[model samples]
Target chain A: MKFSVILDALPYLLEAAVTTIWVSLLGVLLGQVIGVVVCVARQSGGRAADMAGGVYVSFFRGVPLLIQLLLIYYMLPLIGIDVPPLVASIAALGLASGAYVSEIYRGALNAVPHGQSEAALALGFPGRSIWTRILLPQAFRISVPALVNELILLLKASSLISVVGVAELTRTSQTISASNYRPLEIYLAAGVIYLAINGALALFGTLVERRLQQA
Target chain B: MLDLSLLVQYGPSLLRGFGITILCWGAGCLIGMVLGFVLMLLRQLPVKPLRWVIRVYIEVIRGTPFLIQLFLLYSGGPSIGLRLEATTAGILGLGIYGSAYFAEIFRAGYQAVPKGQVEAALSLGMSYGSILKRVIVPAMLVSTIPAIVNMMAILTKETVVLSIITVPELMYEMQTMAAETFATFETILGMALFYWLLVEVVSRLGRRLEARVTRYLTHASPQGSSSETATARA
Candidate 1:
């Protein structure tokens, strides 16, 4: 590998890597909001709501994210919805991630014994307080590591957004490699950036798991 | 609304694409399982350096997106004089990518095998290979089949990314048809159904395998079976 090419492209690639991180962060944030809603709806004990949640999860989970991205990016314009590439990319990633994150949420919620909510209700706590104070906190603690796992997966998946012409880390490396004719060095450098980001995320996840265990 | 006639006309092309997709996925998973087994074995070796090297390989592969890995292999290999056909590159990339996850699954399975059983095998004068072959492998296989099936589903979806490198897989064919027909939604939805069916079949098979294998375990419990099925669904 030519070190010089990597050195020359390091700053540019890092800038694009920042874009990758932010895009993924935004996507996952959106996913969390959507996932929480779906999780709650599915748990609400209404048949129609449960079926809707199931359909949402299955459709998003079953269809590959790349196909979703392409569909959103291309078909939207055909139907006159004209969104920017970034919007389409984030929407696709967020919607797909919502499905997975909702599953994580459901798992964590289930792990918290039903008695906890019953106890809260028997204690005369307000309904909102029962969820926000009693159930959600416990579930959140149990779910942190899984959420982090999903986030790391999302961060890596953001690279697929490059297909829609987002100048993320992978696409940025491809461009630099094309210009410098140093595909090996450039891609290796890009891989290192990805590894660094994910390594930090994994370490953070472990820390959360440990702290949760101690708690 | 889907044009039923268009689907009928495109049925043959989609079937051809589906065949290629399965070929790539099957070949990739085969190579991946072998390499993953090797990696898991190497990780348990007494050599610290070998363990470290295997750990790094797994982390690097698992940390990054498969799309980047595919691009690097497909594009960078030729520059380094490792010329590979598009299909070869796609298969190699998928295999390497899947190996990391498979290695983890196998490692978990290895750890899950009760130590008492291995000890009993050793005390009975069984060779190490025999213990692994006769005892550990069977136990691990029974417990880890669900995880392996889940990985297969993931890898099957991953083959879609291979289309980027010009593999004539189902996704590539569908994308080509979409471009040609400009009926993006119809083409995409049809492909989605195909993928959904494929995943459903794999999942159902995993459940059946779990049911069959659990019968072989002495400590088979209802709770254990349910947990394994839950993991498969996840």
Candidate 2:
């Protein structure tokens, strides 16, 4: 609540903001890539691959992202695959969001008229061309709104990574609270920062949703 | 540490926390549904000022992260005169946060109800309460069940966050075990698996309930395109 303390802390908080943004962006980006691949695989592949992809989506979608963070943060290191706190957070979020994004993508794919796929094949478009040029492009458009929702969810989910001691906005505020013994102001500041980030993401989502609609 | 004793020892703690998780989720879901329905009803109220207040309540809760709201209630509510218990705060936070989503669900459910059906009920001179309780509620239930199920999954996960405020939930128990045993991987992995099992069971039940309701409707009434079934199917 102290303006002076927030001002004094602004620079440090900005640094933490970088981590938050990076983790969110990285997680969302990675999730989208994995999601698209999984959905495509689920649509076209053998029963085994489809089942595997289904399991991946179901498990991640069913559980809380916080528990996933704990597992990724703690369990990965035991298998001799140590990652930095930021990396672990990103990977865990990537896996969780990927599950959600795949569902969105699959839904969008369902929306694309089946005739379009048949048309591309009748026109002798290569398999890759048929998918990339004909199917996926249109499917991506239907998915824009859901994708935005997932992205915003990722931004919020990033807050959980602070528990594993990543110096993100939440952790930074916790650190400041401990140092200054002012839990209220610091927590409030962190909340404001989260609100600001989420505001930006939501606005961007709305803009994209509008653009997609116009298209 | 790598055997039956681990199960026999920590098993009780995990089981105890399981009960708390169920309590938190069950109570929170029920409260959220009732609160959400009431909020939805308020949306239909003719009183402008009261409706506006409820509208703002829905927006603010929906817009911000639920974690901050939980923290705000836990820390700031007590700072005033609330003196709420941690579990109580958790339940209230989860319920209120969820009600926003549920309000939207209810709103959509109401909108999706067949207008002609309402007209029919009105022509029969049925009171508003009876119409709602008998007709609209059944129809809305069909459309709203899927959304309620989806939100249920999200709420189940959110209960994990209350551990930070010391709710003695599953997540906190896992954190405790990790700290004491240094078997962080095992404890965390076990915790995640426990969460997976709880949600998977719920998801299966939701799907089954959804299918059963739709089947019962089509078989009993031969209705064309069930409204509640569609909503719940969402």
Candidate 3:
């Protein structure tokens, strides 16, 4: 293994690694927002609203995230709206991640028990206040693990944006390998970087899980 | 942004690409099944080194991203003196990626099977192959069918990535036509709709397969009479 080449490539890869993390953060944040709306709509919604949310989730969850990325990055330009790589990546990732996160939120919301919502409603509180204070706090606690999983997946799926020339960690490694013919080493290093990112995420997830449990 | 004229222009091209996507997905899923079963068997083997190989395969595949894997296979393969056709490389990469996934799903299915059933088979004079083929494989298929079906949906969508390697799949076709016509909106929106439709059909098929697998496993009458000869006959 060419340790020196990997060392040389690290500086380049690190910048792309930052882009990966940034995109993942933006995607996960957007996904969580969409997820909440979807979960709430599906749970306390009329038939039409519920179906709308359900269909959104089904479409996003059923397809592969990679294709979704490709569709976003490359296909939009066909119609004269050329989105930058980062924008397209985030939009695609968020849409897909939101579907999964909504499921997690749905499970969490359900775990809050009917009695809780009933108690809030029965107390003569406004419906918005009841859902925000009484139900959401409880739901967030239960869905932590699932949300972490979605985030991890988003991180990996971010690598796919390389197809659109978003110079993320994988692309940087590919560039290095192409120049030097040490793919096994370069790729392995890229894998380690991912492992580090994901490992940190997992640790954070576990800590959050513990905090939720203590609550 | 959408009108009938745009639809008419791109519809046939997108549909044709959809067919190619389905073809690649079908081939990839089938190859994945064979590779997954072989890997699972390797992992389950009594030998220690063979087991390590399986562990390594699973770890490397699951840990890395598919995009990177594709890059390695497509770009790196030639450098290694293994000149592969682009489509062949795509299919192989898809198979490799899907196999790691399928192995995990099948392993879960195997774990779900009752230990008592395996013991009952062993109590009789059933050979390993017969016991596995009759009892284990069928039982594993029950849970695995649903997971496999779900994987098929994912695989269908993933075929779009093959476009990067010039596979002429729907996504690639859409890209070319979009770039060619400067009608980005028409091409991508059309492609997305086709992809959505394709996945919807696969999901329906998957649900049906899953239902059938579960139904058959749950209610199929025992063919091998009683425990005494159950293993032997199996």
Candidate 4:
């Protein structure tokens, strides 16, 4: 294996890795927003909202993210809602991540003892404040590890967005491989970049978890 | 706005595609289960270096995207003169990729088996394989249902990635049909439904299996307060 090929490709691959990060970060943020809303709705005591949230989770979790991306990228154009490749990619990822995030939030929220809520209710605390003060904080603490897992999974999944021709790390590596005919080297370099990114995320997650435990 | 006629036109091919998808997933699941069990057992060995090697293998496989792994296995194979058919590569890639996760699940399940039980079996002069076969395996199977089911769902969704390697699975067939007929939305939606139903079936099977196992255990030990049955009942 020629080392120079990897070095020459490293800069370009890193640039695309930035795109991968950007896309995944946006997806994670958007997914969190969707998750928080869906989680709240599912527990909010409204039948329609709860049912809608259930359907959302089931459908998203059931379907593959690749098909989601393809549908968003292709179908939206026909409906006159033309989304750029990157936008479609982010939207697909965000939507799919939302389902998993909602489940994580649900598990975390359930972990917060029911007695705490009942105690707050007996104390005549308002519902919103009970949630804000007693429930969400505890749920957030419980959710940090799973939230980090979701983030790492999303980062890895961003590779699939390349199917829509968004030139992320995988796509960039594929491009270089095509040009240089060095699939082994280019692919290995891309894998290293992915491992490095995910490794850092895992470390950060552990640090945050430690701090949370300390608090 | 999907054309119903297009569905009628492509139903046979699409059904064939679905069959291929199930074939690949089933084959991959078998390989994953066997390999994952081996990895889990290897993890139990007292050798520190061997355990570390297995740990690294699991981490690396779990850390990267399956798409990259597929490419490396399928496309990179020719570079090493180990060229495999697309279907073979797909099955192998999914199995190898899935073994890391399955190994973790199996390890967790194995750990959930009470240590005392294994010790008791040893004191009774039961051989290692016999103890594992009679005690550890059954207990772990019951404990690992949820994790195993979750992994099955994941592996099923991941089969779509095989399309990248030109495996003639559901997604690959749908992509080909879409390119040929330009019925993008219809074909994509149809494929989505196919996958949705496939996942639903797997989850239903998981629930049934869980119920069956729980029922069998409940019948065997009516007074047992084991948390496994407690959670299973709940």
Candidate 5:
């Protein structure tokens, strides 16, 4: 349990933690967009759109994110649409997160009562405005907790991108541990950093949830 | 633009890898459930330190990624005078990681059981063991089936992380095949299909189990069958 090695590693690990955060934030944001699209497709009342959304959700959710990363990283080059490791990693994370996010949004949407939408309809609100102005706001409030959970999950999962050669926190830890021969302390330090980041995310989620409740 | 011939060439090895994945997942789930159950039981005891330790364990495991956990177990083992093979470390990591979640699920399920039912059992002179076996366990199972199933699906996916440790599971096999044949697309698609099937099977089995348990509970106990059905439907 040498403290010096961890102290030396802290700066590098923190830098890499930023990469982890940046990648995961992008992934989560992209996932939210994809989730909204899929949610709309699922609720669009057309069979093809519904089936397309269903398959997208099932395939992405069913397959592991690690495999998704590998698929994107490797398959893109063969198709002449080459992407860097970071791009592939983010894309994979976003695609996989989109599936889970869509499910969360669906649950939140369902929690919003049907009567609200019907009332808006009877009040002569257009369908688009009714959804965007009325229903989505309530559903967004309902989704905050789950969305936070997904973000934390994605942040933790960003470690998998190390497989594609991204110099993220986990990879930096691995590199340092290999060089320093202090796997236990280094990995534990990495774990602490992860815990700190995730704890803050959880706290933020709690605050948001409280705010939503008050509203 | 897609090719199917690669599957014919790599089918046997991929099948073997799939088997290994299933084996690891099964062993890991068994370990997780048993350990989680024990942890849940321990948490119920009136020991402050024990409860505190269990809470920390759950929070730490839930907060971090399983990849870091696996790295700690596999790479960090030698420092602690514990050296484990990749496969052993992978399975052990999955179990330890999953136990935290399962324990929480068990606790929640136990709490979901109505308080009056436990009180009635207590008043009827039923022993703690009997009440646990006849009343609490059944209701807990009915309530926790979905969560348990969800965790199992998660564990199934986590098996892929084992490949990072060179455990030769499905992902490892796919990567190896892709590197060798340059058939990355085919191998990746095959891997995806295999996992999709596995997850589908797990969810289907969970639904069936839930149905059977709900039916058994409905017939065995008439007092709260309606609410049980409502929960089951939900």
Candidate 6:
């Protein structure tokens, strides 16, 4: 209820929000890379590749991201990989987001009419160009909305990375609230910050979607 | 590099934790569906303020992370004179968080019911109760099963956030076991396997339920296009 508590905590929380954005952006970018690969594997018409892609999607999508984070954060040290908390957090998030992103790409690709691919094939276009030049552009356009949704979800899920000791917004809020004994105001401020970030992302997504539609 | 013996030492406690996880998930989902149904119904009312409030509620819940919500409820409760135990706060937070999504699903389900069919029913002198029962319920159920199932899977995963509040769910158990024995790989993998199985079962059950509902709806209607269209929309 104290306005001063929230006002004082705002600077720290805002600083940490930058970290949240950075982590989520990096995670989403990594996820898109992994997603494209898995999507290609799934669509390649090779049995082993398809199965590998399927298994990757199923395992990542099935398991909770928290456990995945803990697995990476803790298991790597045991194996002498020695990844930092931030790296492990991003890796876990990227690996998990890849599953969802691949599905989004798959849906977008399927939404692109099959006839377009066939027509390109009949025109003597190679399969590689058929995908890269013709299909991928359209599919990427179709995937923008879903990709934005995934990005927002990843931003929210990034709060869990606090478990691995990253001092993101949520963790920083926890720290300040514990010190100041104003959990209500601190958490409420954190939630509003999250809402603002996600709201802006949603608005940006709508603009991109509109631009794509016009194009 | 993987250890199996750690499972023997920690398996019983993990199983207990799994039971709590399932309990919280089941109870939370039930509360969510019921509350969500109420919210959906409230949205249908003509009161502008009520509808606006419900809209804001849905947006706020959907916009933020469940971990923050749980923190607010569990840590911030006493400030608002609403003290809650960790388990109670966890379940309540999950329910409130999930209700927003379920309400949207219910609204979508209602919208999916053809407006023309409702008009036709009204023109045929069908009462509101009978029309809802005979026409809307069946159609909505058929259309909403997959979404409902998907929400259930999501809720199951959200239960892991409950561990942050120290609810002693599967993740909490895994964390404790890992801390105690430094068997992070084994315990984390064990936790993942349990969650994977749970999610697989939920999705498989959802598929079965979808098939059954479609069959039932198709069998009830001679034209059968209703179920087909519903499946297509889904």
Tens-digit lDDT track of model 3 for A45-157:
88998999988988787655765776667666766887788798889989888898888888787777798778878889998888788888788877888888778878988
- What does DockQ give for each predicted structure? 0.69, 0.56, 0.43, 0.79, 0.85, 0.85
The residue-by-residue lDDT of candidate 6 on B13-116, one tens digit each, is: 88898888988998999999999988997898899999999999999999999999999999999999999988889889989999999999889888877799
Give candidate 1's chain B TM-score.
0.91
Candidate 5 lDDT over A162-212, as tens digits, reads 988899999999999999899999999999999999999999999999988
Higher-scoring candidate on lDDT, 1 or 3: 1
Q: What is the lDDT of residue B36 in candidate 1?
A: 97
lDDT per residue as tens, model 1, B37-120: 989988989999999999989989999889889888988898789889998999999999999988999888888777888999
lDDT score for residue A129 of model 6: 94
Please list the residue runs of candidate 2 whose C-alpha ends up more than 4 Å from where it truly belongs after superposition. Answer: A1-15, A179-185, A213-215, B219-221, B225-228, B231-233
The full ranking of all candidates by lDDT, starting with the best, is 6, 5, 4, 1, 2, 3
What is candidate 4's lDDT per residue for B77-110, written digit by digit as tens? 7887878999999999989998998899888788
Which docking band does candidate 6 fall into?
high
Q: What C-alpha RMSD does candidate 1 show over the true interface residues after superposing them?
A: 1.4
lDDT tens digits, residue span A13-102, model 4: 999999999899999999999998899989986999999999999999999888888878887888899778999899899999999999
- Deviation in angstroms for A173 in model 3? 3.1
Put down candidate 3 lDDT per residue, B36-119, tens digits, no spaces.
988887777789988888877886787667777777787756656777787788888899999998888777767766788899
By DockQ, the better pick of 3 and 5 is 5
* Number of clashing pairs per prediction, in order: 0, 5, 7, 0, 0, 0
Per-residue lDDT value at B26 in model 1 = 96
True contacts kept of each: 0.62, 0.47, 0.36, 0.66, 0.83, 0.79
